[model samples]
Target: MADVYDTTYGQADYFGSEASPLLARYADWIPAEARVLDIGAGQGRNSLPLARRGCRVTALEPSGVGRAAIKAQAAEAGLDLDIVGENFMSYEPRGVFDVILCFGLVQILRYQECASLVTRLHQWLRSGGTLFLTAWHVGDPSFARLTREWERLGIRSFRSPDGSQYRLFLEDGEILKLFFRWQTIHHCEGLGPEHRHGDGPPERHGEIEVVLTRP
Candidate 1:
């Protein structure tokens, strides 16, 4: 049920609390009437606010649950939104955007997907366009030990409380090293304990925040 499209889609309902400093910082990157793409946009947490700011937003989410959430929000606000119910990897954009907000969904993808996604994102971004991304970061020796134990057991997927299979790949420097084609203008690792909600149990999985731009 957790990983299925119906349950997996709209997060805007519960993720209202997930908005943190990272989102606040990314919001500044959005200009008035900017064209924004909210990839893995679950329920319009950032999308709703961005729309209210007068920005033209396209909310892309694969989960029906997520699509419904964004639909409800946009309808109530009378905001014009283009919602695409498809995977970010396969969806083709007709034009470039001014800013792309990719919050909280990076690790959901495998490393291979990240490579292609990075390229596609760059291709769809206009000159000097900005991209904001967040990823779950591995910090602390305790997490290292636990993950190592899992690896030793040859268990690749972590099962969450909701019976969903969540997988994570990148550790720390891997994402930057792999996706370095774009210039990183702003970077920061999230503060506090880790947060392994998607990858496994709802444990601590610290994060990395990156603001990149094309040359």
Candidate 2:
């Protein structure tokens, strides 16, 4: 299947060339040599930075365009990254990781797929490993527009008119319940920094951010 991000990332500087602010904010918490997995690693923004910090980063991007950009940048920077061009749902993890990043990822899955992916994350993370996650919630401004104008799959889940995109927003405190057993290092729910994708207008997302450690 043709991935949507292949088109989006093909655009000049789709997401720009910066690591996520949330990653920088929590950088001190990660071990310098930790094994890391960056899911939906669009344009390698977060992956490149982590690799530069001496973390062993595996960038999993389904978009061929995005993967090429990552490869190009990694080469220019002399950074060694394991770039995987496969959908997360089909990509089988080989070994446990010390840190896993899910920035701007979970919102793309269906409700059940989100839960299933959490279970997979639990299995992929080593004991005492860390998880950094950011996802949109129902309070996001776009959620109202999506639910009202798009094809509703379920509560807070919608498909775009042309059937090219899917989004599932979290309810307040909903994602927290899934990780009750983990030790929470940080957790917050609210609008995140303004950002844009492709040629879209400046936008904001009501998001949930969490940093947790496994037992």
Candidate 3:
């Protein structure tokens, strides 16, 4: 995965050059000088902007090349960010945070893995902290094929262009079940245009975006 991300598609291009729309929309919810954790923080899309806004940002990424890109970008911008090159599922948090961003990552995990991670995330958040989650869903046009493949092979994944298997889609109800303990601030499910990460053509997909706060 690291090699694939590094060579085929840079994290920056996968997420684009700007902060995600979800991050930009909920910027006000993150307090200035708050401690923030960005799980699967590919190429510092949210990390860089949040750090610039006076938040203490810690970006956790599994890819070395991605982490290096994040560090380089931070240095170039003269921003101080804690870049941890580790998978979010195995990486332990040193302390609770004021905010946690989990964009473009949750759907990558198996059902049980995502459930376990969300449980940990709830515990990792400080009181009144928020969690921003975005994931691919079953409404996607490619989902039917992926589901058929999974059922036939007993594996929930689709083949990537690199010949590697990638995670399949999720349902909106399933996503809600994982974070049921938190107070939802916003929740929406809809279709979105697919933007090619590298050389592939665009393929449309369904997505769910949610913001939940710990009481």
Best by TM-score: 2
Off by over 4 Å in 1: 1-5, 8-12, 17-20, 140-164, 190-202
lDDT of 1 by residue, 131-214 (tens): 888776666233455464433222322333444434454566666775567788777765456444433455555667788886
lDDT of 1: 0.70
Worst 10 residues of 1 by lDDT: 151-160
Top candidate, metric lDDT: 2
Better of 1 and 3 by TM-score: 3
Segments of candidate 2 deviating more than 4 angstroms: none
Higher-lDDT candidate among 1 and 3? Answer: 3
lDDT of each: 0.70, 0.89, 0.79
> Taking the tens digit of each residue's C-alpha lDDT, what string does model 2 give over 102-182?
988888888778878898898999999999999888898898788679999987888889988889998898877888789
Q: What's the TM-score of each model vs. the native?
A: 0.79, 0.95, 0.88
Give the 10-residue window scoring lowest on summed lDDT in candidate 2.
12-21
Tens-digit lDDT track for model 3 on 66-96?
7888899899989999999777768888899
Residue 22 lDDT (model 2): 77
Judge candidate 3 at residue 124 and give its lDDT: 92
